[model samples]
Target chain A: MDFAPTPEQQALREKVVRFARDHLGARAAEHDRDATFDESGWKACADFGVLGWPIKKEYGGGGLDPLTAIMAYEALGEGCVDNGLVFAINNHLFACAVYIADHGTEEQRRRWLPALCDGSLVGAHALSEPETGSDMLSLTTTAVRDGDGYVLNGTKKFISNGPRADLFVVFARTGGDDVAPQRALSAFVVPADTPGLTARDIPKAGLRGTLMGEITFDGCVLGEDQRLGAEGAGYQLFTSTMEWERGFMFASQVGVMSRLTDRCAAYAARRRQFGRPIGSFQSVSHRIADMRVRLELARLMLYKVGWLRSRGRLAMQEASMLKLYVSEGLKTTALDAMQIHGARGYTEELGIEREVRDVLAGTIYGGTSDIQRSIIAGLMGLPTAA
Target chain B: MTDDIAKTVRSFIGEHVQDGEPGDDHDIFATGSVSSLFAVQLVMWVERTFGIAVHPTDLDIENFRTVNHVVRFVESRRAAAAPA
Candidate 1:
């Protein structure tokens, strides 16, 4: 119920904002143009301990609590101009890092988590295939068991952090019946150097710095130990992680909403027409006000998810709701921020266009806004759209 | 020392992460290890598991640099937050 940030949390916010201003701003435009992945910037984040904030100390993590981490991430999102860079970092942490910390065997954790925490490795999630965008249950990727290993054959499309990832958490069908379709799925952690594994960049409509691509696993062989959880648990694993994604991934978008709202308000105050700041007009002022309303609502939901999850509650619907709200809110905010800015917003030269592009994917990826609504409606036992 | 907090952190990871080594640093986010949405959950977990407030300054990759860092920080925070 109470939303005030604690003192410690405030300090972290200041530092992260400063870091974003120093490193991610200005150059955000450069990265957008060159499609640069800011290797130096990524490492600096590592040095600053951005990579492992939520990880446990044993595995080289910062060990901050859930709500605090969310607050910090929101702060990062507020100040960081490069949503792509921040997006990449989110994809890296939640998609790859959490997978290992949760499921890896003792020996596996010993071998991998340190490097991941230290920034020695870049991780990627290889689940989406060329043929399947939302129907994961119907995915065609196959990981057939061989002696001591599995032979994986399939291609994953639009995978974030693909271009430079050294390790991958790949999902493939092991065995399943059509009636209960997800039964055959399994997850695996495969190193990038494996002979049959290849990834190529795939350009996107926005969030350009995320380094997405099409990754083909051509008879890629991995040891039996590489399988994540028990065989045929992929469906279960994926379902559970989605709740995590829906909740955590969208945290930053809340910050984006705030950022857009603040900027729009500032612009409305300064830019003038008809001898008065445009903000004096109901049309402009109302849009900025609506933007503020959406940001606060989104933050409330995000925090609730965090709180419920920390209490060992099933937050599937809450997460879906938060994801759906924040992602959509961000799109609206970006559009408005752009509208208020006019030409500067439309021009690629100003980075506003890129933000609009970047936020559009929020609706599609991490499960589309439509999917989240469906899930939420289903959970609430409400009739959904046919 | 109760592995209580450590256990809590581990369980949070277990419930959400795909199966793999429990401690592989490289395997966390890089390998589709966790969802991008876990930042909030991770923060909440830190607060609950260690019984301390996670300052914003310590929220980035540094405080989360390693699992050990997480465990220690929590212990320290809980200790500091405790009344003498």
Candidate 2:
């Protein structure tokens, strides 16, 4: 069967590739070293509609189809060299913006989405507390109701976009005291300027350019109107958004995988060793070949997921498979990228190592590789051992 | 689902599951009894046939591990969604 991208998709890819090259590629190394989110560069992405590609045009988004949006995002990864900025944008879009789109009431969408779309208001998801990352069901965060408002109290760790998030999609327990948390959780849209909310920058080994931080809500007050869905539907909201995030966020990495291979190939061909290009070596050529295999294979899976999502099909299984495959593929590909370039790949000046470090997190965040496997196995109806 | 419908659902998994032991206790997802993609399809089939929306919280190995477990879960959901 023909798998060629359509002419329109090709044009979209070309345009995003050009934009990313012009804005993010040249400055990738600088931003990597700064350990700060590229505010100016991010706004540039917004202007290019990268921030809102998946969202509807009514909300000031590009209103692109799922497959087309991901294809464009993959192209952005190919052109842009800053993985951190890409991640920050992905978090803003898939995790934060999507929640409002799928579940928010009309007034909520009207008030929050336009600014979020245009990049006026940065967004972040604050669910990973120090005590709870994957175990969201057991999180201690509470939004106890008092009159028409809820008072929030909790702390979230390793939050991407925490420092700059103008709006937060926060999760808190709100069920009756005797009720189990499955029906007790609720989600809200809390402004960053809320009196009791505070965020502190978290230092890290990589992707530091996207400010990760610890977010604390000490009795922060929010109106009932701030609730995105029914009080008990917070868990459902988070789960749905998470499914999208796990499914679509890896689109950029597929693009990044292409970039890794290209970078390695160019270096292998031009960089002389033993009076010949390093790529001529069997070992080096094989690594690059393996990298190529991963790129195409992972791309196919991601495309299937993107298509399924576009069709409004329930893609729980496809998303898990794609997430598991692509995240691991990126790490392995980046590792080979480092190996192919030798010291050049490892050096911070080239920003290649930073990409590897960024890829390292793909398996950890958005649920760990272990977690993906569990989901995959669970979906397979297989036991834990399998 | 009625007893006959429940038996039909069980038989579908029982017959198709590669496990092939054809017992009531066959583990579907974990045993390679069926493909993971089938679980999604089965979930949809259960939802459409019974008109019950399975909550995400209900999606776990505990309830979905075996064919019997799945049928029982579907029955419970059908009962829960039954009109008063």
Candidate 3:
């Protein structure tokens, strides 16, 4: 029942917020405009240990507990103005590095985690493909067993950090059609320099600084040691790990919601119209009020998921709800901020427009809002198309 | 104790299976009796109902492919957890 953070947690959150505000997002506008990753900000975050907040200290990470890590990331989202950079960091940490930490054998962890924590390498997940978006079981990627190795061949599209990632946690079919669909695939940690691997940049409307790309794996050879979990366990591994991807990754979106709400409130209090502050108008104030409500509720859901995970409990249903609520909440909050700001929000000068574009993808990635709704229904014991 | 566990597991699985009730050894996944998500739900349900933790190493599908398997898993976990 204790909702308040411990003193140590509070201190860590404050430190992260301060570090993010001071060191990150300096070139947000330039990077957003040019559609490029912010290498300097990435390095600054690495130097500040922002890259390893949740990883174990034995592996060169800060080793904050799960709930504390969520709190720190929320602060990072609130303080860092560059949504794209935060997105890139989330993909690297939650999607890629945490997978190894959670499912990798001890030797695998020893081999990969220190470099990931030290920022000597970047990480990305490869699941989505040209023909597969939500239907992961239908993925066409194949990894055929070779002598003491596997030859992987597939194309993954819309991969965040793909262009610059040094490591990829890939999911591909290792079992034939006759295998049970649930056990037809396997997970692998493939280095970007694997001989047959290549990446091509795919520009997008927002979060442009993250550098989404298509990765082609053509006869890529991987040692048996590169496998993450047991063979034919990819589907199970993905379902189990999705709590991280769906819950922790969107902690930043909750932060973005708070950031947008505060900014809008400030603007409404000062900006005048009809001989009075915009906050005097019920329409303007109500929108800001709704934004605040969503922020509070999203934070509560996010914390519940964090609490469950830190205790080694299942959070699949709660994570789905958090993902659905926070992604949709941030999108609406950003749009409301735009409407409240009127001309300033619509234009490039105030960056509200960029916020709008950045949040537009939240509902699409990490499973679409529609897909989340289906997951929630499925968990409810109701029949679902999924 | 084993009968009670089997009965409870059967009831839970029965709610999710579309067609007629499955035999103790039916492969629910292979028969499409339940979606893949049911695997996650069944694991969580077993933990909550039987008061035992299912660790990462226990994630193999063989541990949960049928009522017989689930019963065996629950018994093994409970036995391991019992006082010597």
Candidate 4:
């Protein structure tokens, strides 16, 4: 029943917020305008140990517990204005590094985690293909077994941090038609420098600083040791690990919601219209109030998922609900902030427009809000069409 | 105890499978009797029903391929969790 953070957790959150505000996102406008990655911000976060908050210390990480990590990341989102850079960091940590930490062998962890934590290497996840969006089981990527290795061939699109990533966690089918669909695929940790592997940037409307890319693996050879978990266990690994991707990744979005709410409230209190502050008007005041409500509910859901995960418990259903609520909540809060700010929000001056564009993709990535709804229904024992 | 565990698992599987109740050794996955999502649901159900934690290392399909396998997994987990 206790909702308050421990003193250590509170201290870590304050430290992360301070570090983020001081060192990161200084050139958010320039980066957003040119569609460039925030190199300085990335390096600063690495130097500050933002990259390894949840990883085990034995593997060169800070090793903060799950709930504590969520609290710190929420602070990062609240203080950092460059949403794209935070998105990139989340992908690196949750999607790629956490995959290895959770499922990799001891040797793999010893080999990969230090570099990822120290910022010498970047990480990305390659799952969605040009043809496959929500239907992961239908992805056409294939990895055929060779002597002591496998030859992988596939194309992954919309990969965050892909252009600069030194490593990728790729999923491809290793089982044949005879294999059950649930056990048809396998995951591999593929180095970016492998022969026949190439990546090209794919620019988009938002989160431009993250450098989304399309990576193609053409007859790339991988040792059997590169496999994550067991053969034919990729689907299971993905389903189990999705709690992190779907739940923890959105901790920052809830932070964004709180940030937007506070920003709108501040603007309404100061901005004058019709001889009074905008906050005096019921329409403007009500929108800010609604934004606050969404922020509160989203944080509560995020914390519940964190708590469940911190105890090594199943959180698939709760994660889906959190993903659906926070993504949609942040998007509406951003748009409402835009409306409240009127001209300033619509233009590039206040960065509200970028916030709008950034939050727009939250509902699409990490499984769409529609897909999340279906997952929630499926978990509730209701018949779903998968 | 094993019989009770198997019966409970069979009942759960029967609710999802279209073809009548499967035998103890029937491979539900190979028979295509349930959707892929059921694999996840089945894992969660086992944990909740048996009051055991299914760790990441235990995500192998072999462990829950049939009623017999699930019964074994539950029994093994319970045994491991027992005062030792």
lDDT of model 1 at position A333? 90
Candidate 1 accuracy as lDDT: 0.78
Model 3, C-alpha of A157: deviation from truth (Å)? 0.9
DockQ of 4: 0.57
- Local accuracy of candidate 2 as per-residue lDDT tens digits, A69-160: 88998998889888889989999988899898888899998999999999999999888899988767678899999899899999989989
Which prediction has the highest TM-score against the true structure?
A: 4
Task: Say which prediction, candidate 2 or candidate 4, comes out ahead on TM-score.
Answer: 4
Q: What C-alpha lDDT do the candidate models reach, one value each?
A: 0.78, 0.81, 0.91, 0.91
Instruction: Give the Å error, residue A321, model 4.
Output: 0.6
- Compute the lDDT of residue A106 as modeled in candidate 4: 98
Give residue B72's error in model 3 in angstroms.
3.2
Q: Cα deviation of A249 in candidate 1 (Å)?
A: 0.9
Better of 2 and 4 by lDDT: 4
Clashing pairs in 3: none
Positional deviation of A310 in candidate 3, in angstroms? 1.0
lDDT of 2 by residue, B1-84 (tens): 356765767766665566563666655543344542454556756666666675544544456556577778877877787798
Order of the predicted models by TM-score, top scorer first: 4, 3, 2, 1
By DockQ thresholds, what CAPRI class is model 1? Answer: incorrect
lDDT of 3 by residue, A110-215 (tens): 9999988888899999999999999898999999999998999999999999999999999999998788788889999999999999999998999998989999
How does each model score on TM-score?
0.80, 0.85, 0.96, 0.97
- Note the clash tally of each candidate: 88, 9, 0, 0
Best-to-worst order by DockQ is 4, 3, 2, 1
